[model samples]
Target chain A: MEEISFASQLLQYTITGITIGSIYAMVAIGFNVIYNVTEAINFAQGEFVMLGGLVMVLFRVTLNIPVVISFPLTIMVVTVVGVLLDRLVIRPIRKPSVLSMIIATIGAAFFIKGAAMFIWGKDPFDLPPFTGRNPINFLGAVILPQSLWVVGFLVAVVITLTLFFDRTILGKALRACAVNPNASSLVGINVQYMILVSFAMSAAIGAVGGIVITPISLMEYDRGAMLAVKGFAACVLGGMGSFYGAVMGGLIIGLIESLGAGLISSGYKDAFALLVLLFVLFLKPSGLFGSAEISKIRKF
Target chain B: MKLPAAREALPSGRTCGECAHCSSSSGIRFETGRDLPVKKSKNSLHLIGFGLGLLLLPWLAGHVELLGHYMDVMVFVGIYSILTISLCLLMGYAGQISLGHASFFGIGAYVSGVMTTRYGVNPWLCIPIGMGVCAIVAFVVGAPSLKLRGHYLAMATLAFCIIVTIVFNENVELTGGPDGLAFIPGLSVMGHPLDSIAKYYYLVWGFVLVTLLLSLNIIRSRIGRAMRSIHGSELAASTMGVNVSKYKIVVFVYSAALASVGGSLYAHYLNFLSPASFDLFVSIKLLIMIILGGMHSLWGAVVGAVLITFLNYEWLHYFEEAEGMIYGLIILVIMIFLPGGLVSIPGKVRSLWAK
Candidate 1:
């Protein structure tokens, strides 16, 4: 590795951190949405990213489908998957003990992974560049169009989800459901449908996240588990229900990981994320934007 | 057949609550209390079986090497039983979830590893110190995190578990880095270095008996009642003056301490320690064991631990590429169909037979 100047090194690290943070934020956003209404963490949420990228790879490489068709198809499949997940796993044991529900989510996570693995082997599969194979030099550091794609998609998703949650009638209903399921049910709002919607929307966002970023990081069936952990941490660190907090938490986690790895060692990068997670939980428990509702959200 | 006879006694038209079987069978058997004669007779059979196995172990060994393996497994099972029992109480009784318990296991291992490897501390002294360290860490983590109910608490512990794995994987100078500590000196008990499988087996069995008794005692005591109340519903428990949060912290810390003991035993028995063994998978395995065995029973934890450990050793290789898939599938299937786990099946059968 070439030794760069300390000033340049610090700048490089920060840029890397922000780019990674952007990806985490996107993943976290999906976590926040599902958690907000349904109280299911959607453990398979991260796999939407993996599946999107994998589908793109399989179509473009294995099946000879063009990127244009493959990407949209991938997004559609993931949405359907999200809906299916809600219908099958989340809805059935919705009345079980809290631990059972959590176990069910975990089961869903594995089931999805197993399906994905059956479809795609254990190898790390790659995708053609979303923009181009070239690197851009806008940040006084190495930045790829894919990095910009990730950041751009994160911004777009946040804005879109924020509007959907805050301004729309459906969004209001969803929020109402999250705030008080009993009152929402009493008021004739379909709590089950709201939960299903939440799951579908979260899956959609996660799939989009996968498509945009997979061009940078190669897709694998197993990538979702780690991503889910990171996403969960981001939501937790940012406060579980806060949309903006999930975004910020993702960014902060990404930054911590990137910078921590660059300054210290890459080997411990995961530990850094885990440390931040533990610290946030142990110290605040509420996280950056976490509110009482994060804890108040009932699994039972 | 044995279970059918046990079940034929329940009243034909009544559905007594879930505890009927537990009360009849275990009778809240504890470290100190009246030993129901019938329960003792049943339990004594197992005790006698264990005794015979211990006596015949050396003769059956036929070789020193296989004997060592048996010793190793026993110690692991003993330590794991301790950890599993703690988790059983916390989740099944106290109504909390932990995703990061392996971190405490690792913390215990790493503490003992560092003490013996770096500081030249005796393994015996280091064991308690490791447990103490893990207890403090658990308390620190639990104080805030435990306040959060259910899934959040699980996630918090998961975070801690990941952090510990990360630290153990990295931080070479302090933790032997990721390659893990090697050539750890054998542990000593009562001024003798525990070096043989027969001796170690006895040692581990001793701990298992102690932990099993303690856990059963707690389950039968007033503390156990509070834990059960908490499990029923935090609100109801709180309404009943259970001091829900305090009990949570207590169990969380105790579970961590138990995990520490497991970790300590694991490190000394293997004479080596690695981050991979104490990863989140291990924690999940522990959970699955407790869940599969029947969370409501103390023996459930023991059964789950032994069954999973043996199964992992014997059959996991068959599922190689899809090990995780198999594990998740089995657990899902068990939870979906069995609901209460294998232990509950007997009760369910009894109820059916009553009909």
Candidate 2:
């Protein structure tokens, strides 16, 4: 269509893609961490994003509170919800037939989504700008400051998590349980607590993603479903059971989406990650960083 | 990492004397052919009963209170009954979660639409073509993704469904885009188009009988047993040389084809085919119907499908202020307490009544 330099447009789209990708990456990490610990995908993990955005809109927009306060408060509330969910919905069905547990989470997701919609309405909320409203021009390509905030926060969080997982004793205990829960429990590692911690931590990360990308994507009650799909696709493309794979998969999916849009129709761009999901599943099966383990649960 | 069974749990903690589910501390004993198999499958008697029910339905339709609405409700019941049976075949028997099931339904409808509109192909002939196209596409998608387990496979299928909808939405030239195709010729036989709703009623209802017969046969056949085995224990099934992957592929294809058939009939009956009609929500609704019906029996599929269709139109209507909220609440409560579904209730009640 429109006349535009290939290099400039490519560069512009790539930046937008990476910015979007970082959010997807964050959501994937959140899913992977919880899955690694609990062996169940928190279907309501998507709701954490909605909760974060809703809390911000309620506090920052309605009550006119500061962004700094609104963001952390929302994350804390979501973390608490995650803890309660682990204790109730997941704990009772932790035996075998993990499929039922997953279904239970889906039930919980539906309830939560309905509740979110009822409370916040389906309309997209006009999220206030997170950073200063200034565009940075690099080689004649204009970009938003909040875009930098998204990419910066994504990198920072990844680095922090890598450090936490490798360096901290709690992280070690968590990984230890994911590897061998029985061994970890025998070693006084409190596997249940670790699962709860992962859930809470993952929820917190999802909320962070909500706060960062609210300006660009805009906050809405129903946005959780779309974000969840992209995140889930990222997790699948990179590897279901692998943590680091989520990051790479998210970035790759983001690029594929934008580049696919530039090359093909923009409407079909969303299908790119899904195609890669099916492809990687066919070729690798375990994912880029995923370790193959024979599963005992019913394949849902 | 495998904890001992519940009796083993007794040595570790509480015994059957204390635990609610256990009795005499022999552990949570499973029904190893200890109980009677399902005895209430819909049979020739049910066909007779349904025939009577339909005969009675016309008399009921004559009521001043219930006229056109009842017929509309019955038509929906027919449509959803087919959808739910297809889902029960895949999810209940095949042990596969397909979030993109709506795509097959859409393809069937669209194929029928394109055939009738473009090539002027006989609508009856297009039925097989719709089924064929759906089966082939489902195979193409399901075959490769079967390797992925749980959420991965579900997500992949979900992606497939979303992409299909997007294709239907974006390609305006072919699909008529968002506006959807209209004036679909009534499903005719050998060039006779049935124009009236009353005539179409018998048409859909007749097809539904065929669907029910096929489902009943499948569920009672060796193929059905293999599917159940695969669902119950995949590893054990594989060890018994059940060709787990092959059975899954077959069932998935079969389910998709049935969905297509249902879709084609729907397009012709409704005389409109839109992308919005078959979406992820519709697929999930189908899943809900099977679960609600009690996935263990074909009758459950029918009961669930009929119940859900009626509930969506009737019960939810009571909550005009919060219809969506009511639907979500009903789903949650039903999933929690009645996972086997309303179909199980009749037998349970019968047993209780006998006691």
Candidate 3:
């Protein structure tokens, strides 16, 4: 094996960290979307990403479909899955408590993971890079095209979501519902509709993350739980429900993990992210951007 | 079954209400001062019958063709029953869920496995050492996580569990990595080693009975009522002078210690230790067992553990690929249709009959 320069190694780790961090950011965003409206963490959020990658593989590799066509198709399928989860598992409970809802989502997560395994088997599947496998050299370091794609997709998602939430009527309605569901309902916004939309939007985001990250890290059935944990750590660190915080948290966690893997023992890479999460949760439960008063008022 | 009728009389949905039969709406409240003797005598009778059944089980298994191969499985049922029962006390009674409970179990197994196999320490001594480690770990973990409300404990414990599992896999010099530690010594009574499956079964179930007794006593104590009060409403519990945080942490530590004991038994009985045995799935499986059997009831824990163990060992063996799907399906179906769990089946049947 050829030894690489320290500068190149440092740059390489930073790029890898940012790319992975963006994926965590996407997962945190999905968590925020669902949590903002429903106040329940969709534990199946990672499964949506897994489904996205696996389904993308089925469409792109097996069917020989173009990336443009398969991308939307994968998102749509995962969105349908999200809708089914809300309808079948969540809606049936007439009165839901925080504990029960958590249990229900966990059950749904397990079910989705199991179903994915049955469908795709135990093997990890890979997707071709959006462009090609060619590495771009910059500042004495090599970067994969897929990493750029992942980072670019995250930026696009943030912009689109900002516009949708800020300027669009539907997005404003969702924000209103999130603020006060009963009052929003009285004011002519359908809270149920907002709930459904949040699930759908979050699932789509998860799918996009899965699609972009699959080439860099192979997608497998069991990987969802670990990803979900890392993403959740990001959410808690950045302040749950804050989009800006989620992005920041995701990037920080990603960088720490990448640098830890590169410089420290690689075996404990996942632990570094989790330890940060625990420390953040212990020291400051409200997170970096979340308000303690607001958290106190919220039920779960 | 009679107790569930009283449970049904409570006005609240999931929260145990202060019904007429009992002043305190405790989780799995079986006997009250009003009808203490009848309920107490009946419980004692059931206990005697269960003890007899357990004693005869191995003998029956040896004689009956259909039950011949189930002796080993029954030992696992006993070990898992201890785990589920401890979780029931924490989750059902105290109303705190620890999603990373398998970590304590892993600690117990690894400590015992390492001490006996590598250092040649006595297996019995290792059990308490493992419990001590678990207690300290649980205190540190619970002190921070339990201070917050909602799913923080669940998430924190889960992270802790994952880190522990990773440590078990990566620290090859100590844990033997993914290959795990083998050739663990078995438990011995006086000088005689518990080598036979039947002997191991008896030893495991003996521990289960003691655990069940201890848990039952805790439930009936004043501390138990305080725990139930906290479960009903944390704010209300505090106003009632219950040191809510203290109780939660104490219960968390107690449950962790019990889990360690269970893990130690598992290691000694199986004579091996593997990281996979104490991974995330095992933790979830323990949760599923408690939920399936009936979270609130001790009998429910035992029933859930036995039934799930049977399914894993006997029934689900044929459907290996569908195992995860089936476990998930069971959780969904049970939570949706019968959240009260299998222990509620008799009450449901009685209600239907009355209707």
Candidate 4:
């Protein structure tokens, strides 16, 4: 085997890391939006991403629809599922404990996974790249055009979300709900409806992630769990509910995983990420950018 | 605000002397107000009835050809019962969830399998070693994770499980990787190896009964009351000098030890060890069992184990492709309509009838 230059290998891995990192960041963002408002981690967040990819596959590949039309449609469909999830599953519980709510979300995740299996079958589906299947050479490393699309979409989504949360009245309401739902309600904010909107927005973000990444990484029914776990790790690493923290965490995780696979054994690639997660959890329960409130147990 | 205020309304750190429902010194209260002697006798009767049912099970399986097919599944139920009961102790009593229990189970299996297969260690010795390793790992993991409240434990355990599974798959020389380790020696007592299904059945259930008895005793003890207190309110429990964090980690370690025992038995019974058997799905299935049986009751764990074992072995064979769908639907339906689980169904029905 010919020895590849260390610098070139580093560059290649960095590019690969960035591409996958964006996907993780997108998923983490989704988690942050919902968690910010509801304090509930939607375990089904990855299923929205899976639904995005699979729905796009249905529209574009099976039904012969154009990519331009199918992509937005996919996001819309998953957003509706997210709304229905909140309406049918989350809202109906009379007075739910944290454990009960967690179980409910887990159940929802399983339901979506099963539905995906029934709809798309067991086999993984692939989507054609938005552009020609040619690798673009850049500084001794090769990058796919599809990778650019993934990074581009991620950047656009994050910017849009940042703007939405910072400048919009609706986003302000959602932020208020996160800070103190009671106070938000006292101030005439519809906390419950805001929660529903957060779920919708989160789902839409997850869908965009799924659609773009599907061209590079194939979509399968069982892929939701792994994606969710990775995204969750990113969320935890960056600091749950911190937008900048999630992105940084995602990139770091991706880089560590990529470099670990390159330097160490590829077989233990997933373990490296998990090890980092455990280390982060043990040393800093609140995460790098998370609020101290998350670490402290509320006194009755 | 209403919910938080309602939770705070419950009286904290009250002793049995103050509460009329608790007549015993152990602080656990049975809802019934019957006299001590009568309740004790009734409990003895129930115990005897349960014992008789257990003794009758294997005999009936031996006699009835139809039940012979389920003999293997019965052994699995016995193994899962131990796992579920331990989880019941943690989740139901202590109010902590572990999504990575299968890692403890896997460790137990791998340790036992490796010891028996490669090192020529006694199966009995291997079981204890597995339990010890599980306890140590659980202690190390739980110490940090359990300090944080709520879903942190779940996330930590889930990550732990994934890491363990990856190790199992990667360590091909030791675990046989994805193909798994086969030719594991069956468990033996003295000079006799447990080769037959009936023999294994008795052995497995013997362990199950012991586990159940131990759990029942714990639940009836002061320690159990401490656990209940923790579940009710960790703050209150700590305020009452219950050592909430210590109890949480101890229960977690205890549960992992039980899962290790189950894993050892599972390896010996099948005479094979596989990473696939102890994956995330197995952990989820164990959770499902407890949830389906009713997380609040010990008996619920047993019922859940047996019910899910039956479903996996018999019912799901017809619709293999729809397995995930069925499991998902079951969880959703149960959480929606019957969150209290199958064990609570009788109570639910009686209340409905009264209304």
Clash statistics: count for each candidate: 4, 0, 0, 0
Candidate 1 or 4, higher TM-score?
4
Model 1 interface DockQ? 0.40
In the range B1-355, model 3's lDDT, one tens digit per residue, is 2243233223323222234335334455443321121234455676788889999988899899889798889999999999999999898878897788888989988989998999999999999999999999999988998987666667888899999999999999998999988999999989998889989988899999999888877865666766766666777667767799999999999999999999999999998888999998999998899989987787889999999999988999798888888898888888888888897788778767978
Tell how far residue B8 is off in model 2, in angstroms. Answer: 24
Question: lDDT tens string, model 4, A105-144?
Answer: 8888888988888888989999999997899998779999
* Residue pairs with backbone overlap in model 1: A49-A210, A239-A290, B100-B157, B172-B177
Chain A TM-score of prediction number 3: 0.97
**Tens digits of lDDT, candidate 2, A1-300:** 345567778888888889899998999999989887777787777778777777777888998989888877878888887787777666655343544555566666666677777787788886777878788987556798999999998898899998998999998998897777889899999988999899889989998888888888888776776678888878877877566788888888888888888877788887777777668777876777766663333133
Q: What is each model's TM-score for chain A? A: 0.93, 0.92, 0.97, 0.96
Q: In candidate 4, what are the lDDT values of residues B219-255, reduced to their tens digit? A: 6556777777777777776776789888999899999
Best by lDDT: 3
The best-first sequence of candidates by TM-score reads: 3, 4, 2, 1
Docking class of 3: medium
Off by over 4 Å in 3: A1-4, B1-39
TM-score of chain B of 2: 0.85
C-alpha lDDT score of every prediction, in listed order: 0.75, 0.75, 0.86, 0.84
State candidate 4's DockQ. Answer: 0.59
Kindly indicate the candidate among 2 and 3 with the higher TM-score. Answer: 3
- Second chain TM-score, each model: 0.83, 0.85, 0.89, 0.89
Global Cα lDDT for candidate 3: 0.86
